[model samples]
Target chain A: MIMTTTAQATKTAPTTTPARSIARLLLHGGTVFALLALIVFFFAMRPDVFLTFVNVKNILFQVSILAIIAGAQTVVMVVGDFDLSVGATSSLAGAVAASLMLTGVPIAIAITVALGVGLLVGLVNGILIAVVNLSAFVATLATMTSVVGLAYLVTAGTTLFDLPDGFNNLGQGRLLNIPLPVYFAIVISFILWGALRFTTIGRRWHAIGGNVEVSRLSGVNVRRARLLAFTIAGLVSAIGGILLAARLGSASAVQGGDNMMFSVAAVFLGMTVIKSGASNLGGTMIGVAIIGVMSNGLNILGVNAYVQQVVTGLIIIAAVTLSSLKTRQR
Target chain B: MRIKFKIAALAAATALSLSGCAASASSSDNGKPLKVIAFTSGNQTPVGAWWVKAVTSKAKDLGWDLTMIQGDFDFQKMNPAVESAIGRGADVILDGYTDIASIGSIVSAAKDANIPIFAMDSSTKETDGFAVNITTNQQQIADATVGALAKTLGDLKGKTVMVIGHDPHPGIRMRADLAKKALIAAGATIAGDDIQKVKSPASGRTEALALVADYLSAHPNGLDGVWVGWDDAALGASKALSEAHSNAKVTGVDATSEAIAQIKAGGNFLATIEQPWPKILDKLVQNVSAYQKDRTLPKTKFEADDTTLVDSSNAANITPSDKLG
Candidate 1:
């Protein structure tokens, strides 16, 4: 009787153990699992189209600009600060660049000036938040409002189009049948990931975000780190805005304004997947991928755009809740 | 001393009588210029900005005392500004490119002040407050766009078309609905079985591009055409078709320069409707001038003008709507 009972217990333990481990993994990496499940579900539902090469490329191309903007937001989030002005910064840069080109400014010069505008905005934000000790939220909000006004002023409340071909190619041009923006997104992501993972400044940023007081006492130069984070965010956001203008072959005051909310949401969604429950570049990319996939899938399925939004909001909530529960378990 | 006081009273009465006569004359049209308050909630938009410039120029030509109030799509700012301008006194209030529904407070204030509001592109239907509102015919615009799609596709029957629109815009929403019904009536199937609504006008192009690209990815050759409510989104749809090497035709309203150029290039962009904004504005200005000459309002409370469809044949001749002075 003892031998028979032991045999049954051993059999039950093997099956239960694997199931428990799988559940734990899914709980910890909720965003990643959710993304995988979404992809699989879409593919299963539309086997011929959802997983096709062109469709995959389409998804990547559509998300390229978003990936860059979300990455910019992630940089700020890493330092425990987020900028609400990234969208406005992008729009202002694009408008400035486009208007300059219209006035016979060389494309190179216009693009450089645009990057400068972005850097300047970032520096101003850093000064106000880091140097003046103002709240990042309030300071960035002020900058966002000012930048939107500037965008309108630069464009004179008109859409600027018919850009030079060379400049348009930055957005619409393709390399080996892949959109240039896709390559830009990938390179930017890698560079950002490297900066966060390998560089000494990256470690300092992590420390500062982990514990501001401790990092300050340890001579980590918290102010400079935080300032740099904001500046980088501004610069990256500008790149995104410029690309968006290129893609459309036009620049308008409101063109890049919608990225702010989406980028913040992507960063928040990304935070749930990491064990530290902190924002990371990889997790942000996954978050962006998830959003891009959901949009593409729903569009392919002919779902109402409004309903897609509701579904996305629900997924975010679910992912965060699952992550929170896992944290409680730990 | 009594005689001097009697003389002073006689002089005062005479002066008072003459002043009253002058007041009566001024009130009865003694060539006083109209005090005009031109308000627009959409002054940040391209067409809105053009309206501001055009109205200002018109007011100057008519020698009207014009105060331009740009709302920048903010009712909170615009309502109070219009109310203040009303309080300060205006002969007539001119509203441009702002939905009448959004300015209920300003309308109430105008009503209280007994000032009739002349509006341009403010509403599709006649509201009580507006003396007259002139806007483009949305149903006509839809018919033209959908007709272009049908013509390009060779036949509407058994064809698949996507109707893209931003629902927040009343004109766009109405036109999109009309276009969808027209497409179905013509025996074409609506892609996604509904109008694919763009969430925001600011991001309409990007969203439209994604919407088309995604749909094309699944049914690469399934789509015959795309009907967009505005030119910006049409441009996006055109780009998607271009990238995919698809022969699907695209049509849009708002004869923006880019849309005209696309039509001229004979690409995926097949046609666009020019709303004749300048012509509409001129008519409104004329009506206002008639009112200034004699206290009069338009006989019709709501008027919708027909738009010109700019396809390949007439694309070159039509001055792009964006370039209007």
Candidate 2:
């Protein structure tokens, strides 16, 4: 809701003009170029450190949770809604799940209950925005505050650690030489990509984003569609929280607390890519990859964290610039 | 803006309280409520919770009225918290902010109102407002911990060490800088201390896991010892070292429970420096109460707390006998 809509994209309308096609290619293609260029730059600077297998794994392992949440953010944005409560929901979910596990609940039950908490938070958000007709921004922002408060209330701001070994393995486990969370991220992104690209529900969501009233007149359940987008956001954030709990081997009031902005940043970067760029899952994945590589590569190069924040601000500007170019092309 | 209203409200209360306070410094203990604003909720961690609990209990024991307001980690929240504190018209205020810079304006306000501020953790050396700053000798603590690292390793000259330190809080930064300096002076080569930067101390485990995973992948076993800024980071690095199949010894400053557990379990952690926060809390409370009666604040600007260096040989002694449960 906070993002300025540059150009209202018409999905499924094939671009016929050559100049338009060229402009679209340049704008969307720049992120791809920036990503590849960053990889090459890091490799050139620190071939032994950056180009190695272990470091590469570390980058992907770092990328997995952000990608998962950003992929969810992509879908939420496509339906003309914003889920600002994503991070808070994830924190609450993680804290509850960890506390439940420590008290001798089965790990599966604990995790399921955590995801269930996410679902309920989503449902409340959906009811407020859809039924009560609250602004998506206000509804989600209100939920964000309450949910964060609930997280601290439940855990009293303590870090819950020493989860059973099975949960640790979920975070650390690898299948077919890839980390477990990486596999989860891949499967989730592709599924979201296919659903957004191929399905009727997905197209209707694009229709809603393009123009909500027109989509409503065309028989789309705009309210229900927006509600579903939020629910998916909740589930995805919960997954992020669960994986983060496993990865860190502990859950705190802030385990996944700083990710909403990262997810939003990724989705906005996603909007600058490809075929009228209606927040595609593919573009969002690319955006997440860019963040992962930049941080890992910079850390490997021993750039100070303060300098790293400056570099990050610069990249966001570059992404915003590309998005403005997309607007100019239209 | 908040300070404006706070001072205005304080003026009203000062009018009301001046008569009571003027009656007698000794008779002022009519159990009139005093206010306490913490950096954040003490319940944020076992140690943090311990601070809150100790203060609350001490207040109850002394028959003093205590109001606890949990501020936040953001430095921006410091002034607003101070304003809220003034609005409450408390006799004395305790400043628990990790950064002393944020408390500067409040200290001025407190001084104008003839209220005393007992700044906790943050060094008040250059600051004039603190009645007494209760803090550790962070540099000396770091030097002792890392100097022991040099002693244990038998020679600092060629041994590789990684200094994992946090950089946000000035007090913590001082300790990290001192640790790094001591390690380098001892002849140890400092490797990558590139753990993720944390806004609050509670998330050290999360950052430590990611940082260690990445760093250990890059430099498998060149490190002979790990010097962390706090015991949380030490505990985290020990876990990471164990995960990566390296047994590099770890030494840190906080005697947090998890770090002690690591030491008792014979993990890579070798030593930690224990800060007696509760004892400091008791002294701060006692002195603040004393000041309230006699209206006499401390002559000393900085009151240094003692820190104990505990290795495996003395890990049990360092264990928190005062359990929260």
Q: Given candidate 2, what's the lDDT at residue A12?
A: 44
Docking quality class, candidate 1: medium
- In DockQ, how does model 1 score against the reference complex? 0.66
Off by over 4 Å in 1: A1-24, A322-330, B1-31
Across residues A123-192, which tens digit of lDDT does each residue of candidate 2 receive? 8888888788999899999999899878887776566777888987888788877789999899888988
Using lDDT as the measure, the top candidate is 1
Candidate 2: fraction of native contacts reproduced: 0.35
Model 2 docking grade: acceptable
Q: Model 1, A168-279: lDDT tens per residue?
A: 9999999998999999999999999999999988988888878899999999998999899999998999999999999889999899687898788788888888888788
The 10 consecutive residues of candidate 1 chain B with the worst lDDT sum are B19-28
lDDT of 1 at B275: 91
